[model samples]
Target: MRLSVIAKVLALPVVFFVCFFLVPLSVVLMSSLWVQNQLSFEHYLTILLDQYHWSVIWVTIKLGIYSTLICALLGYPLAWFMIRIVSTPLWRRLLVILLIVPLFTSNIVRSFGWMVLLGRTGFINETLQNMGLIERPIRFLGTELGILIGLVYILLPFMVISVGASISRIDRSLEYASRDLGAGHWETFRYISLPLTLPGLAAGSIMVFALSVSAYVTPALLSGGRVTVLPMLIYQQYSTVFNFSYGGALSIVLLLATLFLVAFANRLGSTKGGDK
Candidate 1:
């Protein structure tokens, strides 16, 4: 009877997942495989064998890695400061509000904001020129660096929140005990805090990486048609070229690649945890 009740409780979510995610994904897979009403691997072959496609894939993966690494570097420090150093609840709350406010804004709006700032005559360039940083305004628009900046800005909050939550859950007594045992500040953090926070770090990194790879709007606006990524290619295939088969193949490739990378990250995190 309890098993029956448990199954009933799970029924809604199971049904929702099947109806929404699995069914649509299966349809896409079928579409990718079906060309001229016959099953074929042509679309996948084209994507895999083409040097241009490989370059786009590499660019997509590169951006994801850069964005994830930047977010992790910036987020971990900010999270540590918030959780470990901040003594005032009011100030902490204010900081959190500032972090979250941008998330509530539309991605298109935010991307457009970056477009203005990263443009040649934009605030960043003007300020740099004023400060004698450069003789000429650097070209940020239509470049990988511009896209990276936008992705990092958009994704930074996820990392900070994840790491901050983990840091907050860590017991202060553990650090105190480490210090009592003659561990220095860095030693205490390395032995206790860092290990304890690894799960959150991994989770945040995976989240940021996945989002970065799948991102369309920020890259689209910042790239200025000069740079191309897999998502942009997929969009072009479906919308402009009217090639659903190729688009579906691209989507599946991205989905599979992201899943593999996320699994690798999870495994690495687990191995590190075990070693610690």
Candidate 2:
């Protein structure tokens, strides 16, 4: 009876996935296979065999991995500070609001803001010049570094919230016991807190990676058409060239890459959980 109830509860979500995600993905998969108004392997071969396509794939993977790693490194400390160091409820609420407000804004707005800030004569370069950091303005716009900065800033809040929630749910008694046992602050964190927050870290990393892989607006604005990623190619195929078959191929490849990454993360997460 309990199993039946569980199945009933899951029925709606399963149907929703089928109708929305699975159906659309199936269409793309079929379209990708259709070449020259007939079924063929030509589209897939073109994407896989092209050197430019390979370079774009490499760039996309590199950016996604770097962005995720940086977010985790920075976010975990911020999350810990929020949950542990910040004792005032009002301050915590305000900090959370500040973190989340950017998300409520449009991606275009956020990307444009970065573009201004990172431009050659932008405030960053101006301040650096004033402070004797450099003799001339350094180019940030249309650079990989600029894109990384934007992507990391946009994805950080998700990491902070995920890890913060996990840290909050952890029992304080465990930490107290570790302290009572003469463990230093670092030791307590390394042995007790860090291990406990692994699940949240895993979840946030996966979320950041997936979003980074598919990110278009931020990369488009930040890259200034200098650097091309897989999504950009896909967009060009569909929008400029009007090649739906080739676009569908690129789309399926991106989707498959994301799925492969998520599955790998899940497997690693399961292994870690089992070890515990």
Candidate 3:
């Protein structure tokens, strides 16, 4: 009777997952494999063999890497401050709310906001000029750097939350013990805290990287029609060209690539955890 009750509780979600995600995904997979009412690998071949597609993939991967690195660099310190340094629960809650509030806004709106700030005549450049840091405005729009800035801004909250959760779970007594043993602060953090947080860092990196690569709106607006990513190509195939076969193929390739990288990250995290 208990087992039956548990199964009943899980039934709705299982049915929803099958009906929404798996079924649509299966349709896409079938579409990718079928061309001209016949099974063919031509679309996949076209994407795999083309140098242009490779370049777009490289760019997408590059942006993902850059975004992940930037987010990690910025996130770790902020997470540490929030989790370890902030002693007041109220203050910590406030900070967390501030960090997450931006996420509630639309991505398109955020991207547009960055556009205004990053433009040549924008606030950033104007401030730099006023500070005499630069004689002229810098070009941020239509460049990878601009896109990176937006991606980092959008994804940093995920990293912060992930790392903060890990940090909060750590045993403070361990750090106290290390300090009692004459270990310096740097030594305590480097040897004890950092290793324990590897899994969280890895998880956060995976989230940031995956979102960065597949992101469309942020990249599309920030790129200013200058740069291209895999999603953009896929969108063109489906929406503009009406080539669902090729679009489905591109979608599958991106999905597989993201899954591969995520798996690699998870394995690496596990290995690191074991070593520690």
Residues 5-58, candidate 1: write the lDDT tens digits.
999999999999999999999999999999999999999998888999999999
Cα lDDT listed for each candidate: 0.94, 0.92, 0.94
Q: Alpha carbon lDDT of residue 135, candidate 1?
A: 93
Candidate 3 wrong stretches, greater than 4 Å: none
Q: Please provide TM-scores, in order, for all candidate models, with all chains considered together.
A: 0.98, 0.94, 0.95
Model 3 C-alpha lDDT per residue in residues 165-254, reported as the tens digit of each score: 999999999999999999999999999999889878988999999999999998899998899999998899999999998899999999
**Candidate 1 error regions (>4 Å):** none
How many clashes show up per model?
Answer: 0, 0, 0
Model 1, residue 153: distance off in Å is 0.1
lDDT of 3 at 183: 100
What is the TM-score of candidate 1?
A: 0.98
Which pairs clash (backbone N, Cα, C closer than 3 Å) in model 2? Answer: none
Query: Measured by TM-score, how close is model 3 to the native structure?
Result: 0.95
